[model samples]
Target: MTKTAIVTGGGRGIGQAIVERLLQDGMNVVTCGRGAEPADLPEGAVWVQADVVTKDGIDAIMKAAGRVDVLVNNAGVQVEKSVADSTDADYDLVMDVNCRGVFNMCRAVLPQMSETGGSTVNIGSISGMVSDPSMALYNASKAFVHGLTRSIAVDHGPKVRCNAIRPGWIMTAMAEDGFALANDPKAAMADALARHPVGRFGEPGDIAKIVSWLASDEAPYVTGECITVDGGMTAASPLNPGLF
Candidate 1:
């Protein structure tokens, strides 16, 4: 079947990569972001400017797309601050965008998808599984995503299949900034590259490929699972450090 997919936060980075991949795979794609759509978006996909954090915005996205077979909840934010330094508003913003945004989109799309049983891929983060020093808000929000994925898979099974993709250091702007934080962006990237047992950080395409597979018939038997794509960062231990 030539399926249609709705990708949230699809203007750039990982979401943009997912949108392109789905289109390349011959799926009709509807991509949305908080900012304006890109100028030269792929042919098979349409763009919308909508906030995933709001009910009305989500409703508008689904209404335009219609009967989505795949929903990739790839919208999220990063807040790099100590818990003590962060404010309640900052926490709420992160929760609203990262956690609540996914919820709104999923809840809105589920009814239509339930009729034919669709697939959902939530874009989670390694920060949730492994605590980072200065990213408490983002970490908690992603942890919520993982838990929500499991719950959805269990509750909506025999119809809808839900899963999460926890990405490591992918070469998106997010990673670029982390690199820039050091004296040399190139050196920081090199450091991460050395850390991955595979000897490289991931491309957005890496996560996109995994999510695409999960949303297709190939992954019919899979549900309620979090597949980590962190180059085994979480798997490495004190005694068994990965590549670095």
Candidate 2:
């Protein structure tokens, strides 16, 4: 039987890559986004116009994906501000999409998943494991995700496996926007690239491939784990000299 998978925020970037990868793996892919469906979404993928933070939105997605074997919680937003500069609105929006959205989707889907042995792959960030300056709210939100992923594994275990992927700096539109906001985009990009020992920043496909493994029978024993896909950015110490 063909399994159905639902991915949130699948219109672009890492989520889009994941949707494409899963379709290549031969699953029926249904994805959701808050805006009108993108013109370039993968040919075989189903796109639902919905948000993951609201009950109505979750309902709409679940309705589209009548029976889900895998759920990828990829919808997220970040506010580029320090705690002192962040507004209350920032706090609400960050938590609503990053934390509450995951909770809502899992709550709505886990019961059905529990019946037939499924998996959940949440797209967290390296920010969850380490602090990034001016990203305190986004950091905290991802930390919440890591914690919730573990709890879901403990509670719904022996069947449903839940895990998170913490990706490094991928060259997504969002990351490009971050660079554009810097005082010197070229220097900023070079500095960020130097941090990755691999000599290149990550691509969305790097993370998508791992999500494919963890959600499949290949990783049956992998649950409650937060896999870091950062191209060795976090493995190196800042003190390392330029090894050319």
Candidate 3:
């Protein structure tokens, strides 16, 4: 039987890459976004005009995905503001999409998943494990994601496996936008690149490859693990060269 997988916010960037990779892996991929269907949506994949922030939106995605063998909670937002500088709107937007979206998706899909066993691959961030200056809300929300991943694995167990991938600095549209906002985009890019031991930033495909494996039966025993795929960035010390 062809397994169905639903990925949120898959119109472009990391989500698009994951959708493409999963399609290559031979799964019937169904993806959703808040706006209209994307013109460049991958071949052999379905896209629903939906969002993960609302119950109706989630229901729409569920209806589109018929049977959910895999769910990738990739719809997220970031607010680059210090805790003291953050506004209520910032908190709500970040929490609604990043944390609540994942929560709702997991809750909605897990029951159907329990019927025949399933898996969830959440796209988290290395910021969740550590601190990122001016990204207090994003960091906190991702932490919630990591914690929820563990809880889901523990509670759902062998029937529904759940895991999170905390990516470091994938050069996606969002990342590019962040860099573009920097005073010196080139210098910012260089600084970020220097932090990675790999001497390069990550690509969407890098994260997508892991998502493909984690969502497959090959990783049956890999539940509740929040794997970091950051080109060894987290393994290095804060005192390593550049900061000084």
Q: Estimate each model's TM-score.
A: 0.93, 0.96, 0.95
Please give the lDDT score at residue 33 for candidate 3: 88
Q: Summarize candidate 3's per-residue lDDT along 1-244 as a digit string, tens digits.
A: 9889999989999999999999999999999989898999999899898879889998999998999999999998887789999999999999999999999999999888887899999999999988777789999999999999999999998899999999988988778766776789899888778878888899999999999999998998899999999998889876555766
C-alpha-based local distance difference test score of model 1: 0.86
Q: Supply candidate 1's per-residue lDDT for 152.
A: 94
In terms of TM-score, which candidate is stronger, 2 or 3?
2
What number of backbone clashes does candidate 2 have, counting pairs of residues 3 or more apart or in separate chains?
A: 0
The whole-model lDDT of each prediction reads 0.86, 0.92, 0.91
Model 2 local distance difference test score: 0.92
Candidate 2 lDDT over 1-244, as tens digits, reads 8889999999999999999999999999999999999999999999999988888899999999999999999999998888999999999999999999999999988998888889999999999999777788999999999999999999999879999999988899867866776889898788888878798999999989999999898999899999999989899887543645
**Candidate 1, which ten residues in sequence have the lowest lDDT sum?**
235-244
Better of 1 and 2 by lDDT: 2
- Scanning candidate 2 in windows of ten residues, the lowest lDDT window is 235-244
The best candidate in terms of TM-score:
2
Error of 3 at 194 (Å): 1.6
